[model samples]
Target chain A: MAEAQNDLKYLPLNDLHVELGGKMVPFAGYSMPVQYPMGVMKEHLHCRAQAGLFDVSHMGQVILRGCAYAELAEALEGIIPQDVVGLAEGRQRYGFFTEAEGGILDDLMFANRGDHIFMVVNAACKAEDLAHMRAMLPGIEVVEITDRALLALQGPQAEAVLAALMPATADMNFMDVAVMDWDGAELWISRSGYTGEDGFEISVPVAVAEAFARALLADARVAPIGLGARDSLRLEGGLCLYGHDIDTSTTPVEAGLAWAIQKVRRSGGAREGGFPGAVHILEQMTNGAPRKRVGLRPEGRAPMREGVELFASAEGGELIGHITSGGFGPTVEAPLAMGYVPAEMAAPGTVVYGELRGKRVAVTVTKLPFTPANFKR
Target chain B: MKYTEDHEWLSLDGDIVTVGITEHAATALGDVVFVELPEVGTMVSKGDEVAVIESVKAASDISAPLDGEIVEVNEAIVDAPSKVNEDPLGEAWFIKIKIDDVGAVNDYMDEDAYNDHIG
Candidate 1:
């Protein structure tokens, strides 16, 4: 049985979501809408086929400044493995805060906003991440943007829908950041999102956020999506959720997020092994981690949820791995999951078994993003 | 039809009993994707997990409310699981059981009581 949600915080769009018939649920200590009248299945497919609006204001937004570009970037690089100093203006890159032993603190995105760097960290890790940043960069100023609401307009038709109102939105490429105006209101728009589909994340003032969200939903192509669809979309896109996939104990190399780590930060590069966990991470880079994250496709419709034990064969076999994130991928129209397994058995096509109750269900190791990513690169 | 604390409903007719999850359970589960039914002739005690219902978001166990032997399982639900979400209290009944003791059925709540319990 689930406990009562008496202390859940409400989003700025909470009233609007309720009026729109969203089923509210407690997520990350917030009263977030998990789905609308269309349900998760339809809402997920809608985002893939057309456009959907998501309220992602729960994420922490911050601006770091009061220092030189190289200094600020170097300060951030001391904690993370990503090459922040090399990030060009108006460009965003995904990075993770790591521990001394190659464990991830949190995964986030930082964009070089020309004068200052703009960052967005996971909602669950916001407070801790802020404290960590302030402690690390004592001289640098960390400003939390609290009076803004973040909305994601995602899908194949996302561009067309936003471009009709703000024509400049269509010109932005993937990972590009810019400031646009809509009806006399300033919008910090970025061409990036968790969903693999081409989309834009718009940051608007809380005062006009309701009006802005309503305007987007009024468009025929845009439907108001909830957290349920958001999770499913990111799952199908092979994106990691903070606590479930990448956590304090999981390393970037083991979680398959090594791509987010730039070569300049690794061994044999200009800036070799300066960040936290660089010794262990670089070692893992050269000599691979014992276990690696991989995708799983169940033989049947049963979804192998988090913590489901995985084995090598139908009969008694050695415990190989455990599912971390899984669900019925509405877009993939099947049960898809991501889990950790021995490096040798992580290859695609390796057969595994999910222990459901007392039965062993067959699952095949497959490449991630069951549906191909449609990012406008 | 009577309901248990776990949200399963049972229909008693003579010594035979039919079991399924309530509408509230189906709604909470969102969309039903698959259902693993217990085999016929299996004897189950009260509170024993009999069936597994897999939804898009989660997988839940349906427990037996009264001691009984599985008489028949709903193959229609196995063919199309969404039927449980569509008509959970009616056509989507999970399994039929031959009740060993009729007195155990009294432990379940009636329709009005079950509705209030869910509320």
Candidate 2:
């Protein structure tokens, strides 16, 4: 199809996606490719079995400078629950922008790049996140890096492919960040990705992005993957999408993201009760959340999509919860979903029914990450 | 064989009309993961939703082209929905209906006309 309406922004790889026969669609206020000629199934499977390249330039990348890294980390901790002050140089941590009432503003990844902190936020939440950072920490500069294009090279062969060009990437552990120079072009490469695979997210200047993407695609191990496969891969990996699985109305504890909060940010720790939602979030951590996010596996073939209600039984069961994200898991070879239900019914083997097309289809509650995460530690 | 605007193809044999989705529809849908067919003996009017087909990315409704009673449903395709993608017009036929009015089949487009319409 033709690119979305003129109002939508285009990614740097838009033309290349079209040239590769990608089906373009409107996503997060941008015209993007949902899948290429191989379709989402093949693209998702390719990432699990081999390697896949993703154009994630739509995600917001920003640099926090004009202050010491330690001071910025403490200032940032006031909004997020993570122990940012303890983050080592060249290491990254995943956390969320939490509201005063304990609701998540947005999930983000921030790396302590020594001189400055490098942050990446979801595309849909970038504008507001940047504004929040600017308003919350007045003196520190939160500079949006719009001149860079981010690409994710993920899967079993991702390191091998990147090692061919930058041998230093092979030595880096998961969540390591390094600024490397290749052919005189500066690149910031992070050993992390949304997919549950060993990978790297490379931030290259827009001027050399096209050539860099082409060079990566030239590698036999890497195939161009689109947003469709990216969603499926993250879903199977049990990662939450910003708007669907986790949102402004959901808290980290309720969303089952309590693990992201290190001990330093919790009750009785050195830096406890300092973040925006510390009071309520720590309460939930000490006690328990009313609802918990859990994975759902359909017993049959019908794919349960977002907004499908969940029931406790197959015959006139009590309403339990609603599915937030659901689709066929290409790797699991079955339909999988994630949603929030009463904490009592959040066990892995709990039998629940998903209402599909006016019928109750049986499903089972399971632990997150339908597929085992293969992140290289 | 004839085709409807909705991309369903019908092959008439005596009073029973066999129905399946066209190749163009299958290609657009990518992979077929599930098929929910109407029960046999159910009466359906033209344009009524007679079946539901799901792919990894989306779910689609298969509509009836003519008023008819469902005489037979494709159990094999329901058991293994990939057949709809493998052979949409052959072994993947959805249902056979005893059409209420046989002359209604003439209203559908022939092969050449259907190809032109899609283009």
Candidate 3:
């Protein structure tokens, strides 16, 4: 057990989390806090009602640079289906790297940072994503950023909290990115987050990470939230957790992430079908994928968590799908889940059954997210 | 009160023994969201999983401590599972079992021994 724990890496704010009575657990090769003294339930509710500070430094932050912005955008567009060339400066968009078979390698958020492109990939897939980018786009310089710690300040009051620290942040809208100066530190700030709340993801130098996090926590409205609450929050937001909700086996269309693919990348547009798996992806776009991701609300209080098989009827029948992510939504105050089902069974009012233990429990196909997003658009 | 290695506590009065999870288990499980109790007339043996406890983080099973027949089950915790986190020792008792031997409770760890075991 000791040897296994020694294999895990510690975060820049490890000491701070321990000091705040955080319960450390291993996640994606890092020993991260799962919850604090406030617990997951309260931490989740706090992020929805006020503001929550999250340490997301374990995710990979990379800067891709080329001879020119257009050249870099074109090279990136070869891998992802999003219209990278059309992405304006200071703007970020959600995207995923696809395999030749239309499966998702990893989902990421990339921004056009004027001179270079800034990309953030999942913690678990960072190493593979970097290798894929380096191997595919040899002309572009893919530099991995290791000297920075990422923090997400999220919720309705996130704007007020961050703007108080850096007043320039007040003007930035959702999906906007900027390099703001804070006490001589270069803070790469983005007005976006995973919790479907109006928020900012700040990339600060590791040297000042703890101090900046302390500054945020000092505010009465902002509390340190752990990965436990983060999971429930994003789950309530109808967002995907890479390995669970999406992976190498699921396509963007089946995952219900078609919005990330702009019209220019689709069939009848200017720069259509240049990415990997574009043939299958565009075909699915024109027609439809057999299965689609949908929100699920279990009728009973018991949570129908991931891997619970879904059926068409309460009695014995063939399994239609299974839950990918699920838990008690603190904001919704009910057990909610997301899963894939046949397109015919994916409607909002459609009733499905989840097999729990040995019994069949009724689950309704509800529209996501369980709670409406509070993003400042 | 006696405790099992699985963090279940048992309190006996005559042949009937009330069973519930210890405070240590409750704290480790975080907030309880839902609970499924065994039927009142169900018979169970030692180590038989009789109840299910669902918390925000994960799901766990409550096993029967000794051979017995469930005489009563707590419906309050089934309705409002938060009681298991708020008052684990008192109101959160899951089931009452009429055991064959009253001396079975003595075989488990006492309060001090259980504290040391948890420590």
| DockQ of candidate 3 against the true complex | 0.94
The most accurate candidate by TM-score is 3
Candidate 2 chain B — worst ten consecutive residues by lDDT sum? B26-35
User: Which has the higher lDDT value, candidate number 2 or candidate number 3?
Assistant: 3
Instruction: Score every model by TM-score.
Output: 0.95, 0.97, 0.99
TM-score of chain A of 1: 0.98
Runs with alpha carbons beyond 4 Å of true place in candidate 3: none
Question: Each predicted complex: what DockQ?
Answer: 0.67, 0.74, 0.94
Interface RMSD of every candidate? 1.0, 1.0, 0.5
Tens-digit per-residue lDDT, A1-377, candidate 3: 89988899999999999999999999999999999999999999999989999999999999999668899999999999999999999999999999999999999999999999999999999999999999999889999999999999999889999888899998998899999998889999999999988899999999999999999999999999999999999999999999999988899999999989999999999999999999999999989999999999999898989999999999988999999999998888899999999999998999999989989988999988888888777
lDDT of 1 by residue, A109-171 (tens): 899887888889989999999999999888999999999999999999999999988988888
Better of 1 and 2 by lDDT: 2
Candidate achieving higher DockQ, 2 or 3? 3
- Write one digit per residue (lDDT tens) for candidate 1, span B23-112: 999999998888999999999998899999988778889988889899999999988888998999899999999999987788789999
Tell me the tens digit of each residue's lDDT in model 2 across A147-174.
9999999999999999998899999999
Poorest 10 consecutive residues of model 1 chain B by lDDT?
B99-108
How far off is residue A375 in model 2, in Å? 0.8
